[model samples]
Target chain A: MNKLLRAGFSRLGRSCVFWLLTSFSAALAIFMCAVCFKNMNAHGDAVDAGQLMLNYSTLTGVVTAIFASIYIGVDYSDGTVRNKIASGHRRFDIYLSNLTVTTAAGLFSYVVFIITVAAVGIPLFGSIIMPLPRLFALLGCIFAAASAYSGIFTFITMSASSRTVSAALSLLCALALIMAALTCLGVLEQEKEILSGSVTDGESGEVEFVYSPNPRYPTESERKLYKTLLDINPAGQMLQLAGRAEPDFKLIPLCALSEFVAFTALGAFIFRRKDLR
Target chain B: MEYVLETNKLTKMYKHSAALSGLTMHVPKGSIYGFVGRNGAGKTTLIRIVCGLQSPTSGDYTLFGRSGGDRAIVRSRRRVGAVVETPSVYRDMTARENLRQQYRILGLPTFDGIDEILRLVGLEDTGKKKARNFSLGMRQRLGIAVALCGDPDLLLLDEPTNGLDPQGIVDIRELILRLNRERSTTVLVSSHILDELSKLATHYGFIDDGRIVREMSAEELDAECRKCARVEVTDAKALARTLDSMGIEYRILSDTTADVFAKINVSQLSSALSSSGCELLTVTERDESLESFYISLVGGGRHE
Candidate 1:
């Protein structure tokens, strides 16, 4: 297993996709920081350092999906995976090594994002107003979310028989998760009641506000389900990390860890049975 | 003889068809074993299963001394190298980098023999060019170079000469012969080109419909496909009678043709046939080729 990891990392080091994606991540983070700096100057308002730092999480899921799929997919497409297997490396080791490399890649990009946010963001925006404990907790959740993204995409790419199919499925899965999370956030953010404009009082001809129930408001059971959905999905966790709403730091990490383990196990199972040409 | 690989009743079934059904064969150590079969006759399937790329649905094989069901089979596989169907190479990497990657995978002590291996495969001069830019023959050689890593004892090459020009084919053949002679590497090469296989194989396994129709040594195949004298005459019966008086073994193929399995004196045969009033038309020496033998074994068609 260590040998497999060493080889995997060596390959990962030379991978053009890894370097390109890492550069892209850093560039995107810097661009976002500049945009925030410009906004701060125009509006004369302090930006939240934690929010800006975690902002990269919103796109990390998609980026990790692309990187993980293409990174692992090349092995199958180029038939290099046969070397490892024919060399007597265990299938589980190959799967885990790939998962570890991709997870590390995802975290590497996030680290760059954080570094960019600190270097450019601290001077432009004031220091993070969020408490240190809360900030650390959110950072851990984001890391876990990134790991989950890697695990899921690794599973898809490893189980898929072809490179193209794996890449397409992984990208589609990432997009689908984001859309589902957005729907959950939308439903969870509904107001119980809204002011439906003004009505004139019949006696004094005075204007009065009228209240009506928000039809989209979820029931108690629905709220719990939606909240759970937000806590479990990596994209949903990213939405919370980006300060769309308060995050369940404990539950999100726990769910993300479970996803990592479960996907790794399932992926190993499928890959072990796959017949290669 | 010690067999490096032995399969017993090995079977592999795809979704709706059996790729290998109770197929069994043996590859002797220090021998170039030719795996002969038509297309989709389970040549690659068997190779894949042996290389651990796929698994047998039933039955099992023993590699080195370890059974397929045993955990030690993994360790045994470490001594085996293979290029199945096509060369397995990283197109994005240079020849050296690809060898480095394989060395890393095998957990070799260091990149010690990488240069030597590249030189052996004739890729030492391909400095920094990626495998993607390599021509077909170059890529194939690189694949063999990668397989040569760790100095594997058993080398499995499935159709190693496919898609090669005449010169390319000769290069691969010489390489295989050199490896076998110098390193004593037991090779199992599956190919549709019987003529090429005949040039290198010390042993042969003919497969048809997923089962081995026959397995024999080169000497055994030679004996089976005997040398004969094809004789044409006015009447084969008359010629046979004259040849019978001479105590010669022969098979009459037609009224005017017979394959004599023994040496005959042309002058004596002509005089004897003339006395018997059976005119001798022609006498030509013939030897059955590997292709003809394979066709005879499995019945004939467009082989590939």
Candidate 2:
């Protein structure tokens, strides 16, 4: 088990995929920060550091999807898994190694992005609007989301034998998670309007008023379902955390951790029975 | 005999056909056991089952001493090195890197013998050459090098020389011989190249129709494959009387037939038998080669 972990981490840290992902993600955050700095100068509007960080965290999902497909797919295409098993390593260990390495890489990349953003933004934009404690809590949720992303994508990459299909499925999955989060964000952006009444157009002695409940506001059940969606989807968690809106969203981090555990366990179980060919 | 591998009625079935049906065979310790069979005759299927690439549908096998389904079988497999259909290798990695990864998988404290194993397989000079860029022969040698990393007690090679040139074949044959003699590693090599295996195998197991038809030592196969004559007569007792008098070695296959293992005058034998009130019914010259013997055992080649 130690050897598996050591070798897995060694490959994970050294592979081109790891470097490409880390650089891409860190570069994306810096680019987004630069846009905000420019916006502050041109429009004389204060930049929201927390919102900038939240908006760019979506790159974590994109970066993980790209890296996980290529990195894990290489094992099947090259037949190295056979080398491990034929050398007496269990299948469960192989799956766990992949999961651990991917999660580590994602976390490491997220840290790089955070540090880069903080180095530039703290001086340019002044202190962040969200309190330091809540900010840290949000960052913790993002880290947990990275873990969940690793588990979910690793399962897809390992299950499908074809690298092309695995990669396509991974990209599609990542895109779908972000799309779901974006939909939730769009829904929340609208202020719910209830008991609406409009009256008095005084142009031609027109005096009329109408009142009704707002259709856009989600109902109690809809609110619960939407929150559940945000809680389970790692990308949604990242968005929520980056926005600094989840102080009471305590269950979000737990959901992310559980997603990691559940997906890893399920992937390992299926892989154990799969024929290597 | 002390057997390193023993299978009891081992069977494996696909959805539409049986790959190994009630097949049982053995590999004695310290011998190069040649696994001879046609394609689709369960040679690779059996190799996969024993190597843990696939499971048996019925029956079980024992490796070293532990049987299948035993927790110790995984530990027991640590003593086995195998090259199943294709060489299981990381194509993008260099040869040395590939071996190092294998060393890590085996959990060796250090990459102590990587250099030695590479040198043993004649890949010492493949400096920084990724396996994908290697020649077919080089990749094969690298595969064998990977298998030899753990200094395993049993080596299972499936078509080790499948795509090699003549020189490559000789190199692999010599390497197998050396490994067996120097290390006493039991080898179960499956190949359709009977001529090469004939030179390397100390023992032979001929499988056909997914079951073993015969198992014999080299000496036994040599005796069985020798030049001989098939003879039939009206009275075997009289024919044996004449052949024994003439000091010819023979096996009485049936009441009216015998295979005589000597050159003789047909007329003289006929006259001798007739004088003893026996009639010579037929005399056919016979010489059975190994290929012919295998075909005879399997009934015909490439038939469903």
Q: TM-score per candidate, in order? A: 0.92, 0.91
Clashes counted in candidate 1 amount to: 0
What does the lDDT read for residue B116 in candidate 2? Answer: 88
Residue B139 in model 1: lDDT = 92
In model 2, state the lDDT of residue B191.
87
Candidate 1 lDDT, tens digit per residue, A148-262? 9998999999999688998899999999999999999999999999888898989999998988998889999999999999888999999998789998777888999999899
Which candidate leads in DockQ? 1
> Each candidate's DockQ score against the native complex?
0.75, 0.63
> Over 4 Å off in model 2, which ranges?
A48-56, A120-129, A188-190, A194-212, A244-248, B241-247, B267-279, B301-304
Q: Alpha-carbon error at A126 in model 2, in Å?
A: 5.1
Clashing pairs in 2: none
lDDT tens digits, residues A11-122, model 2? 7765888898788767877887888889889999888676565565667888888888888888877767766777777778888888888888888888877777788777
lDDT of each: 0.91, 0.85
Work out candidate 2's RMSD over C-alphas.
3.0
User: Candidate 2, B1: how far from true, in Å?
Assistant: 1.3
| Tens-digit per-residue lDDT, B1-304, candidate 1 | 8999999999999988999999999999999999999999999999999889999999899999899888778899999999987789999999999999899899997999999988888899999999999999999999999999999999999899988999999999999999999999999999988889989999999998889999999988876678999999999999999989999988899999999988889999999999999999999999987778889999987555
